[model samples]
Target: MSNAPSSPTGPVNRLAETTSPYLRQHAHNPVDWWPWCEEALALARETDRPILLSIGYSACHWCHVMAHESFEDPGTAELMNRLFVNIKVDREERPDLDKIYQTAHQLLAQRPGGWPLTVFLMPDDQKPFFAGTYFPREPRHGLPAFKQLMQGVERAYREQKTAIESQNESLMAALAELEPHASDALPERSAIDAALQQLDTSFDPEHGGFGDAPKFPHPTNLDLLLRHATDAPQTGAPDRSALAKAVWTLERMVRGGLTDQLGGGFYRYSVDALWMIPHFEKMLYDNGPLLALCCDAFAVTEDPVFRDAAVMTADWVLREMQSPEGGYWSSLDADSEGEEGKFYVWDREEIRALLAPAEYAPFAAVYRLDRPANCEGRWHLHGYRTPEAVAVDLGLEPARVQALLAAARATLYVARERRVRPGRDEKVLTAWNALMIKGLARAARTFDRPDYLESAEQALAFIRGTLWREGRLLATYKDGTAHLNAYLDDYANLLDALLELLQTRWSRADLDFALALAEVLLDQFEDPIGGGFWFTGRDHETLIHRTKPLGDEAIPSGNGVAALALERLGHLVGEPRYLAAAERTLKLAAESIRRMPYAHATLLFALDEWLDPPETLVIRAGDERLDAWRREAQRGYRPRRFVLGIPADESHLPGTLAAMAPGERPRIYRCSGTRCEPPTESLADVVKPTS
Candidate 1:
């Protein structure tokens, strides 16, 4: 795949009218692209031609490469159009399809799959026979040329029908076998311990991240570590190693090119282990959990690095990603002006030109502008030195150096804004929006930022007003139209976000909405017999396979989030069914978590909560003191405690909350699982650590 860009030279296709930004991106491709629809599938079956399915997202750099190289090439497009019924799908819009095909690709090729996934499927059964990602326009890197591969696929489909059928049957059987079965016994604490050990083994102590190059945010792992680290003191021994790993990685990420030094949002991932040189796409999903992590880190350590990181990220999200209609935008494209990172990278001369001598000296020293260009002969700003170190070198106070650097950053940001900005995917996806909402809510509560809370509430209102129709949710909303059956992630993440939002600020309406979504999860997504949630809802479009994913992926697993949310909600509302479902899900996922603990970090969290239920705190107050009391209760980073501040006059409470009636004076009622403590008026007594 090449970073070089070329103009598309084709008439518009059916994808021009699609809601998905990714699908619309390929509207002008020379290949006769049909948006994944029943009509297109029927056309393939009627013609008895195999379907050529291309799955990718708008911000994916390789997807753009493949579009420019093959989909836009008239000759290559002609071959594709002639031999097969071509269909284009936005993975964000139809993750169910992406999940199925990507898994199929892995099964067939025995390798990991990525975006720009190309697959050849029998139109009748929609079963894939061949799969790979990013086929070259010309044969290179052991991949067949687009035209040659297409012709061969067509020939094989025609000549080897019986063998293909047999393979399809085997693939179907294998896919079915992947579904996790319910375990007779509950997962023990050993699984959690083993996961921590695995993380310790993979942790790059020198660099502060897991594995080698190509470091993803992996917010779930960080969250797990943070929770474990917080729990260490109660065990009579402090596990500083876990906290160090999480903090160091976060610090490195904030300083490195993975974070936009001027813009304040994180990029998709770091291409190098040092967290420098990122794959420039800015995703809402990545930033949300990251924002929460930064907030938690700040709360845990009182580190200015984390506090500053959280503030900047929250500001960026509110400034750029939030839509006029209140929902968060999906992502920012990696490429702008036909070149990757062109909008973000800068020349040393540009920095010098933009700043005064005093400003330039501090800025250059801190951002490594004095060093050799690290990103394609241009600098992508990363912290190479501290302000204090630079101050020492320049014989200036740290405060003075900080002032100069801040001024320079502001000046450079104004100049950078003049350049062609990256394209923003304006589609408001329910799941992604929920993730952002959770991040915003967590940051709001941690930092005492009402604006962040307001932003989160607005996004939640947008989802509730627009995405929620009748009783179900529409997955994505664009151009005043909301459509598509919501996935498990949508329901699960939204439920989780609502839980977070409730803790930050009490909302009876939001609670009702949360309960409704929870019901949808059980009714539409849960696999009652198997004991976990399916990726697609029961009423969703029937694909070849129904996936009950347990492990975390680019986002946390829906099952993991569902289990965690249900467990918390069940405990909060005193709902037996919710608790039972959560337990069943743990039983289903226990084997997977025990086998590959690191991969199942999110599920492990649910397991952790199951083994030791979270403390539920209900604060009842009539006046302004409610906020103060709640804030005081949240003095430190207590991950295992859920604090809800409800008005004294508030009526129609849930069973658990209703049991603790509000008194004339503010009171706090605490509960762990089914065990409850007597209501207390003193906030300090509730927050104080037990001896």
Candidate 2:
């Protein structure tokens, strides 16, 4: 599945020289595609041609559809090549570019942007003046034909050049105002309560998610609710009902079509409000946060449903998403063969023929295979009944119902494997891998799963070896090449991941790596006086607008993660430099955090930690009791807590834990700021909250 040219005579573009899997995907396209690099930008400026920037990821269905419809067509390619300096970018590989352009598209068109982003940018500054998404080959569905759009754009540039330039100027001004410097006023209890109140209003009580149809897994927002449910209960907060929202959303997502009922993993999002009939693509980013949430949700509610989802998603990653090199792959495409949902959906007759009479009835009854086809003429399986309900309906024990359902799933999953599988985008992104590593480590720590911890450690080892070069990080790795300047999220996420991984399994190397990441973050990404970190490193290419993102989108906020990671590292290592940076960033983002607390979710969480920080417990022991106590200490989701075990044999425990020298007995010390409490042999004593 390569498009690279073997001979000089072959028709290929500059993408053949790229490392991005998405860029290489278009190497054989009829369009003369140029990777988003200095050379392409230079060519556009030198030729006085407007830039046709098309941004998308490889696994995006609409991206592939547009590529097939227009980029691969010789006639359409001619129009593109002749009139514009066509540049292609994989959004995953270059999110800084994507972020700037997506926002620019929003400003110019006054609508939200999506993948297969089509924008006409001025060659002088690469500022978008006109923008759209997925124009058809022929004019249809209120979209201009690809050729027609290009010709019109060319005409606008030639005849209406002044108007386009004016629009570009206005767009740039709008972008500048996107992040106005607000007062360094921190978000308080009222702001946090308001965010919860907002969620309550937007929450879909019947369906389990926020907002209307085409629902996404807003993992950060859900996590915020989880935090509120746990922390604000004692505060007389406006929304003490948050726990219900978090638990209900997690449970329903697992039971609905959004989750892969047989295979274990989640789809990208649901098209319908009920979370039935998802878009079908599975992303590592979505699963990782969801996995961590499910783990905490189980602990918070004492519900097996959350545990089931957490286990299923983890198993799916270990079984399907993880590469042999220990790095997690990017995504699985929504469509298989030529149709969407073709791989996972099943026909009733096919299921009935494959299963035994006893199995078929329970399977159909449990997974809603008995209901009318919800996806075209095929059934995309979702849990139609709870285990208790299935048990009652089938006249069997609850345990027996679960056993039968498990067997049925195994049968179905094996058969599904024989079908045409969705394509896997094997490009391993550093930020996404870091998120998964964190999720895996958190789950392992919560559940005391050695295998999950081991897997996370292996992935971290791979990341350190492959992505970390010199003292800095690389954004992505694929086909034995690690290129592109790592963004703030890469350093921030990996730092957070190393911190999490340290709890599961301590290592001097990982600690050293975390320190280096922290240093690089401060040195390269931080906006000193202004406070938050920039999306790109200081040495990276200058874009139209450098973003210091505070709000969560498809991913958690980078600046928020930076503050959280630095604060934790600062406390754990006794470093003032890290602590100062975290405080400054929080102060910079404070007002935004106050106004839109839900949008600034991670920031608010960081603020909560900063104002009244979590205890950093360093357990000095190696015996079974120590391990049990470590698990016991982390029984619930305490977002502020960072519990680490320093086995008696462990060497190079950070200087903060120097007092905890290995002795005959295992002792736990609760360290907060620069103070350490008396060593405790009892788990209950160590777990107690400090007055």
Best by lDDT: 1
Tens digits of per-residue lDDT for model 2, 200-240: 89999988999998999999999989887777644756244
TM-score of each: 0.98, 0.95
Error of 1 at 220 (Å): 0.8
lDDT, candidate 1, equals 0.90
Clashes of each: 0, 0
What would you estimate as the lDDT of candidate 2? 0.84
Give the alpha carbon lDDT tens digit for every residue of 363-467 in model 1.
999987868999999999988777889999999999899889889989999999999888889999999999999999999998889999999999999998999
- lDDT measured at residue 159 in model 2 versus the true structure, 0 to 100: 93
Alpha-carbon RMSD, each predicted model: 2.0, 2.6
Q: Which sections of candidate 1 miss by over 4 Å?
A: 1-10, 689-691
Deviating ranges (above 4 Å) for candidate 2: 1-10, 180-182, 233-240, 622-624, 649-655, 659-664, 688-691
Clashes of 1: 0
